[model samples]
Target chain A: MWRDALLVGGKDLRIEARSRVALAQIAPFGMIVLVLFAFALGPDQSPLVHAAPGLFWVAVLFSTVLAVQRSVAVEAGDATRDGLRLAGLDPAGIFLGKAAAVGAQLLVLQAVLAAGVLLLFGARVVHPWLLLGTCLAGAVGLAASGTLYGALSAGVRLRETLLPFLLLPVVAPVLLAGTRLWQSSLAGGAPDAGASWMRLLLVFDAVYVALGVVVFGPLTEAA
Target chain B: MAPAAPVPAPALFLRGAVALSGRFPLLAGVDLEVAPGEVVLVEGPNGAGKTSLLRVCAGLVPLASGTVRVLGGDPADVRTGVRRRIGLLGHASHLYDDLTVAENLRFAVRAAGAPVDGIGPACERVGLVGRLLRTPAGKLSAGQRRRVALAALVARRPELWLLDEPHAGLDASARGVLGVLVAEAAAAGSTVVVASHEPELVAPLATRAVTVAGGRVVADRATPRPVSTAGTGVADVA
Candidate 1:
């Protein structure tokens, strides 16, 4: 299973590297969203700083949709999905491999978004460890849940419009927990407050990851 | 006393298999049995479910009812590992556009847990050696892409070969290469089932011919020879 996961994950990452779609298109789109957030909230840096966590996650959320879309789109052409199915790898491994690839891409996106928040919003990081943990946890949750929904919507027409609707609602808990964790981490509040949200993110990640691994096979086969 | 000889299981066995696409039945009822080293040709018109049958055998499509056993196990049951020994070339080439021809074949072999050493020879066999192997699949012509897909299949050397429209995009030479490859695979004990609109290209090579219409098999016949040296003539199946 681990072998299949690494092979699949490596294949996806290599495709992304060659295509540069994530780097050129999705990442830049994320930066643009960041710039737009500042404009919409007015030129005042105070409002931007106050809304940094929400804006950052909002950007991540939207960009994640793009990333997931591209990831799934690569399989759309040809019978690539069927190819993966016929490879006979464990379905859980396929899920993990895809989620890992998406997680890796989102991490890069989040890193740039983080810098955007710090530089553009003038948001200072009070606890770097806490902030990094929240980002990693949130990214995992997003990748897991996003990949599950992506597979669900893969065979459907109008999936482009359908995916965000399916993914955004299901991912609300992650958004809520991620936002609160970011707020607590940046504020340097009591470690317990951050810990609670961190626990929430961890739970979210575990639940979706498990769900993805269990359901991906049947879902993909059904399609 | 002489020891009892063992009987080999059929490479593919389907009994009253029914499958659907949404509300419509794609395979209302399909019963087929293909022996080891047999080459079966599936011919049908558009919307005739030829592709779906191959997909079903490959375990890419679910059967609504009835039993489908490929390589001695239910293909529907993924844990059986039936899929690992099956190579399917469907309507799409299944190659990543971003990956080079060589990379695509390598990926397929690796994914199927086959030896990576087969890559070089597979490419050569498919006439994709040297610079062509390095060319991205997205840049290749339709015929070239088909060759690459065939190379991947050759490298994997699956026990069961399920090819849907195998001759669709190939030129005469490539089509001949395809025929040779299919013949070689079956000669080596692999069972092959090909669904083609132009059945004549594969007709002489087929051990059996099955025709599907309205989601059911309407005809099944045995051919005179296991390997045909006849010229390509269009089979009037439609």
Candidate 2:
């Protein structure tokens, strides 16, 4: 299963490398969201800095939808899905491979967004470790859940509109926990203060990842 | 009395297979049985459930009723090893548009757990050698993409071959190559089922032809004599 997962994950990453969709389109789109948030909140630096964590996560969330959409779109054609099915890899492996690919892409997107937030919003990271951990856990939760919902609505005509509605609500906890964790980390609150939020993110990641792996096979075959 | 020879199990079997699209029944009742090494051609009119039949065999479509067994196991069930031994070439090439032909073949080979060394020979067999292997699938013409898809099929060397409209976009040479590959696969004891509107193109390679209409088999006959492919154009019966 791990072997197949790596094989599929490698294929996705290689495709992204050549397509440059994430780098050229999705990453830029994320940066623009940051700029838009800055504009919406005015030029006052202090308030923007205070709002940086929330705004950054919002951008990540929106960009995550785009990234997840593209990730699933690669397998949009029936032939690709059929090929994946016929290849005989474990369905859980396929789910993990896709989630891992999405997580990897989101990590890069988040890094860029983090840099943008720091430079544009003048936010400081008081405890870099906690912030990093939060971002990692947050990305996993988002990607796992995003992949599950993506497969759920994969072949539907309204997938583009439906994905956001289905995904946004389920992922609300990730956003909330991620925002609080970032706030605590950036504001020099005690490191343990954000531990509970981190735990929530971890739990979210575990449940969604487990659910995705179990249900993905049946869903792909049925869809 | 001498002991009787054992009967070979069918490569694909569907009994009372029923499938629906929304409220409409696509496969009202589909019962098909293909013995090992048999090359069966499926023909039908548009919306006659030909594609659905193949999808059911490939485990892509869920059965609304009845049972389907491919290689002695239910396709609806998650059987990785069973699926690994089957190759399906649908209307879409299934190649990653962003990846080069070589990369696409490599991915397919790896995914099927086939030997990586088979890639070179498979590409050669499909006539996708040289610079064609380096070109991304998106840049290739439709014919080239079909050849790339066929190359992956050759590399995998699956036990069962399910091809849908395998000759739709190919030129004369590619079509001939496809026919030869189908024949060769069956000769090697692999079961081959092809669903094509251009029946003549596949008729020469098929051992039997089954016609599907109104979500059921309308005709089944042995093709003892090969049909000429000359002047055969796409007939949208199905």
Candidate 3:
């Protein structure tokens, strides 16, 4: 299954290796979100630190959605979708490959935005590595949900318009939980809280990955 | 020369398969048996469930109420390894518009875990040599794009090719090229299932043709079809 997932995901990454769609959407959107975050709350150290958890997570969530969707949209538009299915490979492989591609793209975007945030607002991550972990965790969530939503949207009329509605609702549990978890972790606010939220995120990751694999073929093939 | 090998019994067995979405039934009791190495051309009018049947056979679409078996295992089973041998060609061939032709081919091979170095021979098999290696997929003509797609099968050398309109856009010579490659694939013991409106292309490679209408199999004949003995529009369907 992992091999299959890698195969599908590799296809996406291999194509995006030369394609600029990832760079064009992911970097700019991430940077812009960071800019918006700076404007929304700034000029105070205590407030910034207090707000960092929510602010950072918010930045990660929205930007990742756009990046992930754009990645899947490429697959949706061309023969890539059918080819993957026809290759007689696994759908989970497709999800994983796509999720990983979008994940790597998110990592790059997050790094750039993190640098931009430091430069502009002097807002530095409490533990830079933890923030990276947050980005990674958040990425899995986005990819898991976005891949399925993207599949669903591929069938829906006007996918661009429908994706947000379909995604935001399904994506809330992870976004909210991830946001809260990252905030608490960053501030060292709740180290021993209910592991259920993060646990939920993990379970969401596993189930959604499987769901993406199972549903993607039909979801994409549907009208 | 010896006679062609007889197709083994159907590996994919669907018994009265019915797939429905709420009130709309995509298909009703579709009983299909696809033998190994059999060239079954699935035909239908638009929305007649040609794609639906292919999806079911490939184990992508779910049955509303019926049993579908791929090589004697449940199709919806995530662990069903039957997909490894089945190849489908549809509108979404997954070709990268921005990547070079060679890059796209290599990507498909690597992603599918098929041999990678076969790109050269695969390209040669599809007659894609010299003319369009460095060209981005965005710039390739429609016929060239189909060749790029056909090159996909060459990489895997799949045992089955489930195609939806394989010859949508091609000149007379181009059609002949497609027919030859298809016959070569089938003659090599591959099962080819194509759904198309082109009479010239189907008549040549088809061992049996099934015309589908209203989401059900209307005709299933095993008689030999007319080979492409002449130019386009000359091959007759029986």
**lDDT (CA) per prediction:** 0.87, 0.87, 0.69
Q: Write the per-residue lDDT of candidate 2 for residues B164-201, one digit (tens) a residue.
A: 98888888777767777787788889999999898867
Error of 1 at A130 (Å): 0.7
Interface RMSD of each: 0.8, 1.6, 3.0
Candidates, ranked, TM-score: 1, 2, 3
Segments in model 2 whose C-alpha atoms lie over 4 Å from true places: B226-238
The residue-level lDDT of candidate 1 at A42 comes to: 94
TM-score of each: 0.95, 0.94, 0.78
What does candidate 3's lDDT look like per residue over A158-191, in tens digits?
8787877777777777767766665655555654
Chain B TM-score of candidate 1 stands at 0.93
1 against 3, candidate with superior DockQ: 1
Across B1-238, the per-residue lDDT of candidate 1 in tens digits comes to 9989987899999899999888899898898899999999998888988888888898888898998999998777779999989998877888999999878988889999899898888887778878998889999999898888888899899999999898888887777778878877888899999998887788888999999997888999998766754453222110
Predict model 3's lDDT versus the native.
0.69
Can you write out model 1's per-residue Cα lDDT over A81-171, one digit (the tens) per residue?
8788888888889889999999999999999999989999899888788889888999999999999999999989888999999999888
Each candidate's DockQ? 0.80, 0.68, 0.42
